[model samples]
Target chain A: MIKVQNLRKVFRVHKKPPGLSASLKSLFRRDWIEKVAVEGADFTVEEGEIVGLIGANGAGKTTLVKMLSGIIHPSAGEARVLGYNPWEKHDAFRRQISLIMGQKAQLWWDLPGADCFQLLREIYQIPQQQFDHQLNRLTQLLNVGEELNIQIRRLSLGERMKMELIAALLHSPRVVYLDEPTIGLDITTQKAVRDFLLSYRKEESPAMILTSHYMEDIERLCERIIIIREGELIYDGSLRKVIEQYAPYKRLTLHLQNQTLDESSKEIFSKMGEKVQIQSDQVSIQVPRKNVTEVAAELLRKFKIHDLSIDEPEISDTIEILMGGKDLRQE
Target chain B: MFVNLAVQLVVLWALWTAVFAESGKELVGEWDLTGILSYGVMVFLTGRVVRGGDLQMAVASEIYDGSLSRYLLYPLNYGVTKYAQQLGNVFPNILQSIVMAACILPFMGSSSSVDLHVTGLLMCMPSLILAHLLFYIMGLLPQLVAFWADNVWSLSVLMRFITMLLGGATIPLSLFPEWSQGALAILPFRYLFEFPTLVILGKVSVNDWLTGLLTCAVWCVVMSLLVIPVWRRGNLRYTGVGI
Candidate 1:
């Protein structure tokens, strides 16, 4: 379990102007600015719960993860993972958790992946039998048994990522913090990684906090979603609630019978909510969730329709709306 | 790497050979050309075996580039891990030194008036390892300055030159003024090279050997203790903010 209250990280960065003259001047007198990377994030996650942390660039997802994992101390407030202060870096606390950052590699580049895994085993003091069993299962699930023997640098990025997962999970940590685990991987490889995490969680039920920009990764794996923007927590709830609260309109597609939309029809469709697309024989419109029935009846009476369909708003679109400064709170 | 080493060897050989050749043994007190040449060979050989400049840079780059997060995340001591990695580099250098000494030692003879006292040489082993610890700490001290500076490459280079001069690698300690040698003895650098060389040559009395060992132990403890505070302060400012 993880609990964070008012967790914040403020970075003091040096400011410098461009050009040689400014650079020379900065040598004697430099400016310093405090940039808040993560601001007042408060959340609690229970066992076997997978939470998706979504945010734009500089949204503080990585900063929050770093604080919880004890890689860096927070500027203010407190956080506890499994009732232990992460920044204290107690040896017992470290043994129970694992952090996998996508851009930064944990494996030894010059050595084989197997070597790093062995080193991890020693560091965590895992029992040999458990280490071998977990290693065997994780490798088979990721289909990377053969790749582990090769030097890590020689493997493709996707392959290396798979090995990184195995390395992080070999000790069967009780809690895992994953930062963009599927980043830079091909679609198929991305799917494979998602499947591996899902299956691993089913068996181990580790408390996981996954931060990613990929909407599919969130929709497919995380039931509880936390959205942050500009270093502030904006929304926290189920994925379905996010769609219901932020995206209040359903997409309506209409196929006109042997006729294109004339000027009068275009004017009528625009009244519904927003026109998504217009074509020779088909037109798409967005309709508010409450007025769906009334709008459908009106459109049916005015237009000679062939077929019509209504679709729930997409999670991606809902995320966009949430990030677009919509007041989408559903407590 | 060998080409660079050969060039450096030639330069050092020329410099010392010139000093002795022109001064006609006056420049090297109580030492002839053979003695100076013998000391020069030992200096270069010692450098080959027990270098710390590269180790410092390695640590600095890791700290600057954020790869140190790997150690911070794990339950291992970063200092001990780095020291172990550095210690691994010494074995191959020891092998090279052995091979080179086998080929070169016989030709120098007693003209150098240098004695390879078997007992003293045996006693120097522990002191040599202690010296390695001292240099390892010395290498790491300036690197922790990376918490404030962007690059410590120049600092490392400067530290190397100072160690080479004061540690008796560039010139034997006997060539310096007696007072200067006394001051150098109070510092840790002389233990890194000159004291070990003296211990090996049986120049130090038994009482002096015990005292020298105690001094090396004290420096080792002091430097090791210094790392704790430096590392703590460095970590406070680290942030680990970069990608």
Candidate 2:
């Protein structure tokens, strides 16, 4: 369980102009800029609930997670995880939670993952039986059977990430914060990671707060999604509700048996959708959800259909809209 | 430890032989073969006790990798952990220094015209340990600067060099000018090397020993006080960047 109230984090950064002269001048007279990284953000995650924290880059998602995990103290306000003040950093509090970052690793570089796991076992003071059981289960689930004995540096990114997940979860934490857990992984590996997370959540019933740019991960793992923008919470509710609120259009792609349609027929379909682009034998159209059925019926009656598919607008698009079309910052 | 010591002893023998051959004597000043042996032992011990490299590396790496935040979160005191780690290093250092001394003692032989009082030598051991602790603390103060400074390695190395020179690790404090000697005597650096060596050599009076011990005590207290405030301020300034 986690509770956060009016949390804020401001970073003071030195500003300097380019060139040798400016660099020299900065030594004597420097400018300081205060940027609000996380501004008065608030959220609560109940026990055993899997929540997806959705945001574009610089949405303060990681900042909020850091505060909850006790990695950094909040500039203001209060955050409590599992009834313990996170910033206080009590061992008991640490024992109950784990923070896993996809870009950064906790595994020993030159040493094998198994050795690192053993070191963590001692550090966490895990019971021998529990450590062995968890290690076996997690390695099996992540499908990193033989990779455990190999040095971490020799493993691929996906394998290393799996090991990182295992290292973080070896203690069987009650609360887990996963920041972009599936980032940079291939589709199959991403799906495997998602499946593992889902299964782990089900079995352990830990409160998990996940942040990932990939919508598929959220779709598969989280029923609840919280969208943040510019250090503020913009949307907090069900995933379906977020999609319905921001993106009301369905993406329709039609494959036609005839490569070319008459100019007038193309014009008619153009009137039915906002953006229509024809490529090769496929005609792609963005149509409002309400008009999808009617539009498809009209197209079926008018043209020779070969293959057709309908898809909802990506969650990334909804997030971009929520953030006012700002570019997403990559970690 | 033994391996490292044997290597150092070989280097020391080569250095002393060169100095003696060039000078056309067995020694220089009051330093005979025995005194030179003591000097070599002290040098080896000082170098061994200088655990500043590891401490600086640990601090810089933690700060650079953003794992320093992990320290802030834990209930354990950072200062206590540092002290404990330094203490752990001392064991290997002492063992190595003894091995090096043993290797050099054979070369000097029993014919050397010098005597070591067992009681005084025993007393000097604790003094040497305290001196090492003082040096370590002094070294540690600069390491905390890594929280703010970009290049802590060069800064730490510069500081360590200055401390070694001023602390009489390179040469005896007696060889310096009277005013410089007086200044060094009051500073923590002299207490770290010169005073401990003098005590072991039986060259220090009871009053001088007490004064040196008191000076070291005051420095320890002052440095201990200074460290916390600096650390707290530094932690506030830490952005926990690259986490």
Candidate 3:
């Protein structure tokens, strides 16, 4: 279980100007700037729950994960993972949690993955029987049998990421923080990773926090999504609920047979919603969420329609709009 | 590796031989030419064994490259892990140094006359281990500055020169002036090389060895205590970038 109450982190970084004189001046006197990486974020994750943390770059997603995993201390507020304050870094707490950063590697580069696993075994003091059982199951699930003996640096990026996941989960942590776990992987490898994570959740039922730039990953893997913008939690709810709250419109693509270039029909379509596009035989229009079926039926009865299709707005576009402050609800 | 070590020994022999010939001196205080040659051999071998391992840059690199985050996420202590890695590198070099010493002793003009001093070596084992730890901490302390500064290579280069001058690496402590020796006696550098070499050669009395051991213990404690706050502050400043 994870409980965070107004967690915050502020980093004071030195600012330097260009030119040799400014660089020399910085050695004695320097300008400082305060960067608020995470600002008063609050969320709770239940056991067996996987929540997607969505944000633009520098929106404090990684900062929040770092704080929750005890990699860095928070500037204010508190976070508890599995009944322990992660910043305190208690051995008992650390043994029950894991953090995986997609850009960072936890494996030893010169050594085989097996050796790294053995080292982890010693560090976590895992019993031989349990270690073997977990290793066997994970390797079998990820299909990384022959690759484990190869030196990590010699392996491909996807294979190395698989090995990283194995290393992070060897201890069977109860709380997992995954920051872009599927980054830089090919589609096939990404699918394998996603399936493996879904199956892992089924088996282990661990509380998980996932952050990824890929919308498909969040849509497929996370039932609940939290959106953060400018270091503040903008939205926190189910994915479908986000669509309803932020994007309350649907798009209609219609194929016209005999209805040609007509200004009156164009005005009617525009009255329904915005005219997305108009071609020789096809026309697309945006409709309010409630009037989608009614508008489609009206078009079907009035015009010589060859085909009609309706689609919901994309999650990516909705998030982009939300992040730009155009569609966010007022406080 | 062996070739490098051999070449280093030859260079050291040539340098010291030139110094002795130019100065027109056969003895330094109580040590004769042969004794000084033996001391030079001991210092070379001991210094190689202590400083040859590759973990000297461990802390600075981990800080700069963001690998320290891997250790922070675990329950393990970074210092202990690095110490273990450095120790693992040290034992084999110690064995090799002993072998090399045995092979070179006959050619140094002592003709196997120098005592191996097995009992004294056994007595010095604790002091040597403590000395190794002291050197490790001292080497690592300056590197912790990497967390604040962008480059600490100069600190490492500077440390090598300081250790060479004060640690009795290139020259024996007794060869220095009496007052300089008295001043160096209060410093930690001499114990890293001079004390261990003296103990190995059976040159020190039992009381003196005991005193050296106690002094090593005190320095180890002091250095170990000093590393705590430095490491704590360094960890706070670490951003774990480029990981």
Please tell me which predicted candidate would have the highest TM-score against the true structure. 1
Q: How close is candidate 2 to the true structure, as a TM-score?
A: 0.84
The B-chain TM-score of model 3 reads: 0.90
Comparing 1 and 3 on lDDT, the stronger one: 3
Error of 1 at A109 (Å): 1.3
Q: Model 1, residue A23: displacement in angstroms? A: 0.9
Worst 10 residues of 1 chain B by lDDT: B45-54
Model 2: number of backbone collisions: 0
Sorting all predicted structures by lDDT, with the top scorer first, yields 3, 1, 2
Over B1-243, each residue of candidate 1 has an lDDT whose tens digit, in order, gives 346546755776688789877877644686666666666666666666667334858878887888887788888888998898888878888777667756665776675556766897688777778888888988899899988788798998999889888998877787898778778879999888877777766667788888988999899899989988999888877766462
Question: Comparing candidate 1 with candidate 3, which one achieves the higher DockQ?
Answer: 1
List where candidate 3 sits over 4 angstroms from the true fold.
A258-272, A288-302, A327-331, B111-115
lDDT of 3 by residue, A1-331 (tens): 8999999888888899999999999999999999888889888999999999999998889888888888888889998898999877899999998988888888899999999999999999999999999999999999999999999999999999999999999999999999999999999999999999999999999999999999988988999998988778889899987877778688899998876858998888888887468988889998988899899999988898889999878898787777777536473
lDDT of 1 at A273: 65
The better-scoring model by TM-score among 1 and 3 is: 1
- Cα displacement (angstroms), candidate 3, residue B217, comes to 1.6
Worst 10-residue lDDT window for candidate 3 chain B reads B108-117
